[model samples]
Target: MLRKPTLLLAFGIFLIGACANLIWVEPKIYMPGSTEIEVEGHGINGPVDILPRGTTAITISHEITNAGNSPVPAGYQITETVIQWVFQRNIASVGWREGDPATHTIVQLSQSGPALDPGESAVISFGPFTVGSCGLFGETLELDSTNIVVESSNQDNEDKHLFFVPSNQIINITANTINGTLYHKDGRTLTHQFRINSGGAGNQWLYTGFSWIATEGSTADAVPAPTGRVPQGPAPQLINMFVTPKDHDHSPLGFGPSVKGKVTAISTDGCVVKQKAVEVLVEHD
Candidate 1:
């Protein structure tokens, strides 16, 4: 058994050692970092650019991960993300802003309670922000913009994305001459060539689909016309379609004078219509 003073001294020494250990030992350090690139919409495979017509606003999504060995406290769940957009047409300028053009936009993208544990990831979506114009546009996203989070690495906190919106003249239509003939009509089949232009990034017609209609003004033939559909492939620049005039009259419109006709195309998505007139030479038997 130890004496009272010796026991007291031992207890004091133990306490001192405990205090030293508590003070000197390193505390658990956690850091939240963004691992995936920010995308334009909610879905992972959503379009980054080539937005549909009449799209005035959009949303963005990104993933954050706790890359440390410890856990992040729920108390520090405040969001400090910043998103900025700039027009990229002929001249670069500021994109559309909701209220107070002078003020910047701050986004909140925090998850619900339950602290973020190590190796855990959380996905957050930000915005319904304006889509300034129908042209090339650029935007920047910076996570932890306020610098409130103590991160081991700050280099990966920023990302940039470019998107495009097309004007009303998204596609161009043209009639090509077939085999030396200005506009050839084989039997009753009238062939016309069309070229679909992409709206900077993706073909706008691909999403909505397209159809064509041809009318012969001179003869008013009552032949059934073929149904039209937008062609799909790896990348299609030009497409040709054969149209038949509806049955009505077989009156001779004269070969030398040519057959005056018009081709009309309408997009399935927005009902955008484009018309092209052509003169064809028919060798009717």
Candidate 2:
């Protein structure tokens, strides 16, 4: 027979051995980082419609989710996650507007706050803030392009499914200077421009005649003078077009309350092809 203390000791040893076996058999997974994150839109661009306005606030939110099969391990942690906007060119050479997002700072979230459990998600809010200058540069002194980026312990967060979509997509044809006011007094002479552009994109041609529509009087009476060609732009990207003043195209308020200018153009088939209307507003001042 065993003494009472001896019996108790033997039972305790059995319990310890059984517990050890149970714990070891259980699977301990060590995937310390997030596996997947959620962004609302497709491509590298956060939202297809988001454009950086000089003063208007724009919001970009990304959901960081733990997509692993198991919880983050005890010893390992995600130190930080970085969010930023980047401007890039097709070629490797750095661009004039390329680098970090100027108006906004790169966001860094510390993982020290809490351990991420598998399947749990956190939404990272970037901005309800506006951006500053677009950093545009062209022969006509216009345009800028930028895209979004998110960085973390995982590279897939920022680079996954990259289409490099632009926040703002400009129309192939753009007008720069109307020169004079939309609303102008009668009998005043003014000068203005319609810019034809192609940075080696293609050959673009206008539909010859540009005309204005007057609300009050006949189109003929509204435009006392006809359209004429105007030359403009910097070297290499220089574009020339048929431009005119509002007074010449649509006289003034006697013709009506307002006037609108309209013309059309078609690009050469081979390069960057498009057929679109070119328009501008000239008011009575």
Q: lDDT per model, in order? A: 0.41, 0.30
For residue 254, model 2's alpha carbon misses the true position, in angstroms, by 59
Model 1 steric clash pairs: 221-246, 221-247, 222-246, 222-247, 222-248, 223-245, 223-246, 223-247
> Cα lDDT of model 2 overall?
0.30
For this target, which candidate reaches the highest TM-score against the unseen true structure?
A: 1
- TM-scores for the candidates: 0.35, 0.27
Q: How many clashing pairs in candidate 2?
A: 8
lDDT digits (tens) for residues 1-285 of candidate 2: 569989999999665433100001111111121112122211121211212222233333434455544444322222222223343322232212323435334333333222346566544333443333332211100000111111122332331111111222122444444333343343333333444455443333322234455454312121222122221121222122222324434445454344445432222211111222333344545
Worst 10 residues of 1 by lDDT: 20-29
Error of 1 at 76 (Å): 5.4
Across 1-285, the per-residue lDDT of candidate 1 in tens digits comes to: 669989999999665443100000111111121112222211112223445655566665556666655565554332323343332111221122222224434343443323567667655555665645444344455555555555556576565554544456455556575522233334455355555454454444431222332343324221123124442222434544443433233446632424544433333332233345545444333
